[model samples]
Target: MTLLSLSGVSFAYAAGKTVLHGIDLAVRDGGNLGIVGESGSGKTTLLKLLLGLERASAGTVSFRGAPLDARDRGFMLGFRRSVQAVFQDPYSSLDPRQRVSDIVAEPLRSLKIGTDIAEAVAQALRDVDLPPDAAGRYPHEFSGGQRQRIAIARAIVARPALIVADEVVSALDLTTRTRIIDLMRALSTRTTFVVVSHDIALVALLCERLVVLEKGRIVEEGATREILARPSHPYTQRLLASTPRMPARG
Candidate 1:
């Protein structure tokens, strides 16, 4: 089933400054999709549209076969519950003042899920390979990778159906990046993922299908391996050539 879709979607910041144009895309339930582009490619803008942070100037955005309706409280609430996001820069994404438990439980509190919030938080931490006691600490107490793990914990606490991750590992070191990617890969078994990144190789690791954008429009969309092997667009070829190759695992 199609969980999220954009048809003929176009967006503009102002009367003249259009950011995205005629974009059509969709993700099936439990699908893993990657949106890849460099800065100014409208990747983030497209993400904003998908998240309902911005509305399209020209097309339709739909979730579960229904058009996105911000005015409909019921639809908005259900959409919020079904879709969750993990952003780039875990250090900044997490609150420094809030305890880890509170950070992870915020979604549950806001969504009013009715389950035991404490148990959900604890399970989220454990799922991310963090110890139970880590919940009592602040975001600053952990390493970069651990902090990202905490952020992941927060994202998964609600058992969201779709996860939109934007540049999630761009700020981490190689070792930490690999570990986080592996963690996300494992999580994909139970969740649909929309991974947005400038790093094509990293996206290749997590997403089976990829959509390459340039100048605010999709330049190529296909299977990850096919695109990697035979890029049809000049921009895609450049993107692939410029991205550093991932190191071989032992």
Candidate 2:
């Protein structure tokens, strides 16, 4: 089932300054999708549209086959509960002052899930490989990778059907980044993942499908391995060439 879709979506900062153009995309259930693009390739704009932060200028952004209605409180509430996000900056994404348990339980409180909140938060922490005691500590006490794990824990605490991650590993060191990626790879089986990043190699490791965006337009898209093995678009080829070693299916 397609959980989210954008049909002929176009966006512009102003009348003439368009960022995205005539894009058609769908995020299916239980699959990982990567939206690959360089800086200023309208990646952030598209992310905003996907997250309902911005509406498309010329097309429809649909959730479960219906056009998005942000004004409809009931629909939005359900949408928020079903879909969650983990953002780019781990340091800033988490509130330094909030305890880890409180941070992870934000979705549960907001979504009003009636289950045992403490148990849910604890399970989320365990899912990310963080110890039980980690919950009492603050975000400042953990390393960058651990903080990102907390962020992931928070995102999955609600058991949302889909998780949208925007450059989640970009802020971590090399060793930390690999660990986070491994965590994400493990979690990908638990829920749908939509990973947006400029790093094609990272996407290759995590996403089974790929959508290459250039100048606000989709230039190439296919199975991740097929695209990496033989890229048809110049922009995609450039992206692979620029990557130190594009990840390939073995």
Candidate 3:
């Protein structure tokens, strides 16, 4: 079943400069997809369109066969409730003033989800491998990896069907990156993931399929393993050649 789809979608800024052009993509329910491209490749713009932060200039963006119309409050609310996001820069994404429990419970509270907010927060923390006591602390108290875990905890606390992750591990060091990737991998078994990253190696570990974008267009797309092994596009081949291989796990 298709959870989200973009058909001939296009976007342009007020200056009339196009950022994305006639893009077509679909993400199935429980699918794991990666969008990869260098800077100025419309990767982030595509995400913005998916999130409804920006409207498509032409064509359609749909969720579960219905058009994404922000004016329709019911549809907008349902879409927001079903989809969650995790971004890069754990330090900045979280509020230093808010306790971890409150941070994780924000969505539940704002969305008026469960009646037992405390239980939801605790379970979320546990799911991310953090101790129960850790919820009382502020974001500054945790290390970078731990903070990202908290972010992940908050994202999944609502049991969202889809999670959009944008450069989620780019700020961390090698060891921390690996641990976070492993956490996401474990979560992907139950959640659909749309990962956007310039790090091909990291995306390869988390996604089964990939969409390679260039200058506002999809240049290549296929199974992750196939593209990695036999890239047909020059741009994709360049990406593969430039990405440093991750060291083998012991």
* Clashes per candidate (backbone, < 3 Å): 0, 0, 0
Weakest ten-residue segment in model 1 by summed lDDT: 241-250
**Where does model 3 exceed 4 Å of error?**
246-250
**Model 1 stretches astray by more than 4 angstroms:** 246-250
**Count of clashing pairs, candidate 2:** 0
What lDDT score goes with residue 155 in model 1? 89
**Using Cα atoms with residue i matched to residue i, what is each candidate's TM-score against the true structure?**
0.97, 0.97, 0.97
- Show where candidate 2 strays beyond 4 Å: none
**lDDT against true structure, model 1:** 0.91
lDDT of 1 by residue, 102-212 (tens): 999999999888898989999999999999999899999999999999989988999988999999999999999999999999999998999999999988899888999
Candidate 2, residues 1-250, lDDT tens digits: the string is 9999999999998667999999999999987999999999989999999989998899999999989999999999888988999999999999988999999999999888888999999999999999999989999999999999999999999998899999999999999999998899999887999999999999999888999999999999889999998999999999999997756443
Q: Candidate 2 versus the native: TM-score?
A: 0.97
RMSD, one per candidate, in order: 1.8, 1.1, 1.8
Identify the superior model by lDDT, candidate 1 or candidate 2: 2
lDDT of 2: 0.93
Q: How high is the lDDT of residue 8 in model 3? A: 96
